[model samples]
Target chain A: MITPELLLQELQTAFSKHKYGAEPGELYAPIGYIMSLGGKRFRPLLTLLSASIYTDEWQSALRPAMAVEVFHNFTLMHDDIMDNAPLRRGEPTVHEKWNANTAILSGDVMLIRAYDLLLGIRPELMGKVLARFNQTAAEVCEGQQLDMNFEKRWDVTEAEYLNMIRLKTSVLLGFALELGGLLTGADEASLQLLYAAGENMGMGFQLKDDLLDVFGDPAKFGKQVGGDIISNKKTFLLIEALSRAEGTYRTDLEYWINAADFDKNEKVQAVTKIYEALDIRTFTEQKIREYFEKGLNALEGLPAPDGRKIPLWQFVHQLVERDK
Target chain B: MITPELLLQELQTAFSKHKYGAEPGELYAPIGYIMSLGGKRFRPLLTLLSASIYTDEWQSALRPAMAVEVFHNFTLMHDDIMDNAPLRRGEPTVHEKWNANTAILSGDVMLIRAYDLLLGIRPELMGKVLARFNQTAAEVCEGQQLDMNFEKRWDVTEAEYLNMIRLKTSVLLGFALELGGLLTGADEASLQLLYAAGENMGMGFQLKDDLLDVFGDPAKFGKQVGGDIISNKKTFLLIEALSRAEGTYRTDLEYWINAADFDKNEKVQAVTKIYEALDIRTFTEQKIREYFEKGLNALEGLPAPDGRKIPLWQFVHQLVERDK
Candidate 1:
């Protein structure tokens, strides 16, 4: 079986080979631009990893695996327009680079292209895979809507937030693994286990993102640390802070959140101080650990023999351990 | 085999039974709203009619037929956003009724749901159907992008305008027929004939739309006639007039097109006179007739018996005869 690094290299090679540039330059150019501005290729790597656990012919999964990556980027393109986000991965978003109409239409094409890639799946498994994909794709939209709705409301519950993240981020991760399992001829039980494993890992992964936003080293995080606090983004930490803060803490946090004009660093620092007093960091870290353990348990419960699961287990750990 | 009328009735019943409403009412309500606002249901009717040409299992094609309608509405939802149009089918568009973000997200979900409906295809034919659907879906987006691109340029050629309408409006019509053929176990040769017939018919259909926009009787048209003239929409007639007009005719047409503000009725009258002077109406009618003949020729070339093909042929003629 290929190591995770080698599989990732292979995914990149496949993406680089897949030309997004086509006629109607207005539509395809932005698609090519976004696909070229590469990300970690993390979801596709998980797909390939999951496939390797069942078969040596994991290379067969590459095209379908790339489908997950393309769909992920498609979502990012449209979400950026809705969010009014100017930058993505330190580069201008599709909407910013071109315009929202281009982004929306190009994103729609990317989605169609993703479905095109899924056509590479074996015919016997195609229906099941597509059904799963459609369900996941709709759930992701639902999740985005929920996330947007939470923006207007102040009383977002932790359970609601977790479900939102699961739908928004985690489900695709789970679908990636499940798709791999289905393609590699994994039994239903094993596929369920793979989905659960990925879903749990995804939950932990999002929490890690929440923690990194507020507390991680800025250089290592590769983004503006405390961006969440600065924007009062309703992340797990902020939601927890809102839920747990007492009189003075609540009043102070509210002041910063509602402040129309203030020093960015000062607001971030003040919110960080509030988080510290409430012990939100520790609380979030513990929650992350719990989800990761649940993920590990799911992995152990997989029907695959212990040896076959070892590489995936190790790769997932290394993934979650990334400082950024 | 189901008659086109019976099949259409069945299709309507099927649509009425299928629910678009789901959780996240913000996302789904617009979807339900748009789906409920009745169009002619022309595309899916063609699907059912085409299916009846191949097999007695025409009823089996109803769900996949609805897929085409749903996908068509999805494009309209997004295109209305790009066009910033407020009305569709005499009703407020999704974006106007709700918001652009809601319309966009709902349209995305609508596309996913279209795929879900297509999954009703038999497993053996699933990949082929999905591949075709994705290809058609992408071409539709490319067409819309080209249409938007044309809005910024005044030098669009007649050929370019035709191709744009082909991409934006025609291919899906072809795909609708082809999807019906595929679902009914039509042979490849028959499917190709069905597709060509639909494509040519779509070209004619769009040209008729262009003609109706400027010239149709207002009572029969059911829409505001001269809308294309008022908006200076670069339709086939306008493109041809731009290409053919000379001297004073050219200057008058150009003046109307470039006018910052003008009386709506006066502009419409002037453009109508220019269209008459340049004989563009006759030229456009000639083109529409040519396309309809091409579509009929393809239908005649089908491997199916003359008897089996008669209903589809009659259905096509009836569809093209619509005044509104």
Candidate 2:
């Protein structure tokens, strides 16, 4: 009967309770600081909710749930440093408040703290839990490397970009839910299905982020619209436009892409025009919907699924359909 | 009866065998590549030697020993990036060969691989093993952060710098020996003494490094002498020199320290003259020997002490007394 909002609230409270205490404060305070910046907490909440569907005492999953949150924030702290980003969630990043070295060292400790939190899971499941976590951790690193690699090359394909995001972003989501199921002693089939569901939803969610960067209402988006477009970041719409554009349109797109100095508004407008000409946004939307459908289908495949799953499903649907 | 040389060779072979076979070889290859560069493998060899003193099957400690090696290299990879050092053990650093981004990612995966190796230890002892490893990991980060913080301030005290190096450099040595002892199920008291021994010895080893920078015979040092003095680094001698110098001597020392551009050799020679006048080298050597003696006392206190402990002690003694 719990709504997604309620689940998220519970997760937020749990995360706060486990917040780094005074002695290790320097090492872990940034983790609490970053997590309290009001992230979606979607991944950890999915862990708790998925565990709830199988077991009554979802509270047992709290520590492991925090592990996911800690791991996510750890990655974010380091990623912001690498990206030289000044702001995250419309606020100063950890490296901005603290130095990059502090951010890097603190992020490293946060990852270790994640492992410490994960060690609290039932001893019987420790091996499986650690194995899955290790794989997810490595994949996350691989995804990051690929994302960085993408920045150097001009010819990144749509499939390559998708795979990079899937590995870097979606796989963690998949592991978050799969971890919940494993902790709850769910059957192998159920665990696999849940992982697939989370992953598909994650793909859809990222696609939505890319779309919102350009098409979203600025008021609703909570940040600058077309930020990615101005940066000439290779998003799905841009990649599709690159692949499908012809002679004259292609030349214009190339000019905009290569131009080091141009009116930001003018460049965004011109690129948006090309995307419209190619129906790139429509194509991206269709792909997003396809993955959203796949995620829902995976959820549907669960045997005798509890009614409690509806709130999460509805939340995801709302996410996909959101303009921001 | 194993010499440090023989133990080092075995440690190298074991480290080389652990495949860091993650994709994007250019990114993850640095992990294996750096380990392959080989810096005597001193820490892991100490672990094996400590274990051998307790039990004959030191081979049982190989994985945990390798854990120490991997962890040490992980810190080096990240530290080189932070220090902006172009060389490691006379070879191009991971960041130099690949890039900072790749080095960061590869260093991350190396930490994961360290855990993977730690996981290979006997399951019954895994908790104590991981707990020690976690504590060591956090301390290492704390030390690195403190070292970075010290760089911004000129008032860094000798005690503060020593504490930083102890945390930054020595705790891992303590943990390595402690882990080896724990894996062999040595008595708790013996493990404690062994850890203390390693820690005190590590501190002495660091002091020796500081001493060698100024006082070492160039033929034995393998690099230009007084490199630390030339860089105006706050080593033990420099700190002592600053604390003890009076009037003209203090002003001259401050001048060299504050100078923007000066002959490197002249600065080193000027600092060396001040240090000689103050007998700071003799003072530092006395302090180093005191720690070495304390380390020996701790080693002698171990329960059911074995003769094998003698060679290990002798090896560490040799490290301290060596010109290099």
Candidate 3:
């Protein structure tokens, strides 16, 4: 009965009511701004949905759920600086809008604020909650480090790349779900299942991001497709293409990747063509299915009856099935 | 029976044994690198010394003591990027050695690792400990932001400068001492005293740093004098001098400050003469003494007998009385 729409409304209310800090507007304003920018609130949504499995008062999980969102935006705000990104959600990045120093300092505070929010749960849960969160948080940093390391090298294996994404993007999602369940006082077995499902689902979600960047419909995708291709970002599709491509395919892919000057559209077209020849899309789809099935299977193991879990199921399914 | 030298040796051993992270060398090596760069270890030394006042097994507080050290270094790593400083302790900074992104990410993990180290304390203490640490961490970030805000303004007041340094530099030192006492099961009233004492001590320590930058001898100071004056950095002295100077004094000070081109020694000497005319050094020394006395007075309130606290008292006096 706890729908994603209801979760979204409660999250917006919580975020607005929350005051990050009062001093030095430069440090706290960006946190409110980024949280307001509102990128689907997927992690928090997942948290509330998971919390619903154990209690009807899923709304109680809102603050910790917001912690996941705050942590996510913290990474994005900092990552934008690392990637030298100009726009996020079609707005100037925190660094671009303010300055890199503001972004860095502000982002640092947001990370702490996330921990502050995490502290809102029951006292008995503090030890477990903090330990798990610390682990996930460190892994996210490690994941980002690996992604940065992969930037200069073309020899990055798929395993290394997957581990990077798993650590960077996926673990938090897992933590989000696990946190909700833990807060709701779900048994250990159920919490484990929830974490596994959320983590695998996160991998699926990221890979879907990779696919949609190339193959998603322009009208539906909202953003331009082939952005990953144009940038030669080391996404799942690109990694797969690099691994499978040989001779002519390899030559064309490498040429565009290294091209100092070329039309962006042409690079996209050429790379998409090379990817097509390598059946990278199908390979990506299979990987996506594999992850989704793994996640769904874990979710199925939960004791909550199918009737009670419909909304959460549909929410995750929408992520998997969407083209955008 | 506890000695400062014994504390330093234990701290160094703890730092050497600590493993920040593994796998991605780029992400974690800088943690080891910056920590190894080793400033005076003042904060950790304070923590362990504070612990000694409460328990003979002060060595048990080593992990949390290192937590203070780690948190301090985390700030340095990120602040180096914000300040765009190239050197930390006369060696290249983390960002200079590994780049800004690495510094940012590694600094983040260091912050979390600080919390992880805090977890080494008892479970029952987690809530109070995390809440206090969170407040201190956020305040530190706020202080850095204010420091950054001061960069462009000549209107910065002495009070504003003190608050900034207090937030930026003092609170963590306070927390470091307070944390050691908390870990060793100090009573509520005593813990409060330790925090106030350490915080004020930190203020004195920083004020001394500002004073030493201008007045300390080059042979003993180990770094150049008047570096703050040369940069027109809005430290306590500059703020005071700017406020107090009038007529001919103001005119002469403005000449050195605004002169786009001048010999470094000429600038230093001109600034020093202006400061001498304004009696700035005495004002700075008086302020430093005020803070040191405030701290020492609080330390006096602790139940520990005078003999048992000799090491702690001498350690503080050494900081107060040092030429450098």
In order, candidate lDDTs are 0.90, 0.83, 0.88
lDDT, residue A58, candidate 1: 93
Any idea how many clashes model 2 has?
Answer: 0
Docking class of 2: acceptable
State the lDDT at B77 in candidate 1. Answer: 97
Candidate 2 lDDT by residue in tens digits, B71-174: 89999998998888999999999989988877877888888778877765666677667778887898888888778777777788888988988999889988
The 10-residue segment of model 3 chain A with minimum total lDDT is A118-127
As for DockQ, the candidate ahead, 1 or 2, is: 1
For model 2, the DockQ equals: 0.44
Best by DockQ: 1
Better of 1 and 3 by DockQ: 1
TM-score of 3: 0.97
User: Share of real interface contacts recovered by each model?
Assistant: 0.85, 0.33, 0.79
Give fnat for candidate 3. 0.79
Off by over 4 Å in 2: A1-3, A19-32, A303-321, B1-5, B305-314
- TM per candidate comes to 0.98, 0.93, 0.97
lDDT, candidate 1, at B142: 88
User: Per-residue lDDT for B213-265 in model 3, tens only?
Assistant: 98888989988898988888888888999999999989988998899988989
Candidate achieving higher TM-score, 1 or 3: 1
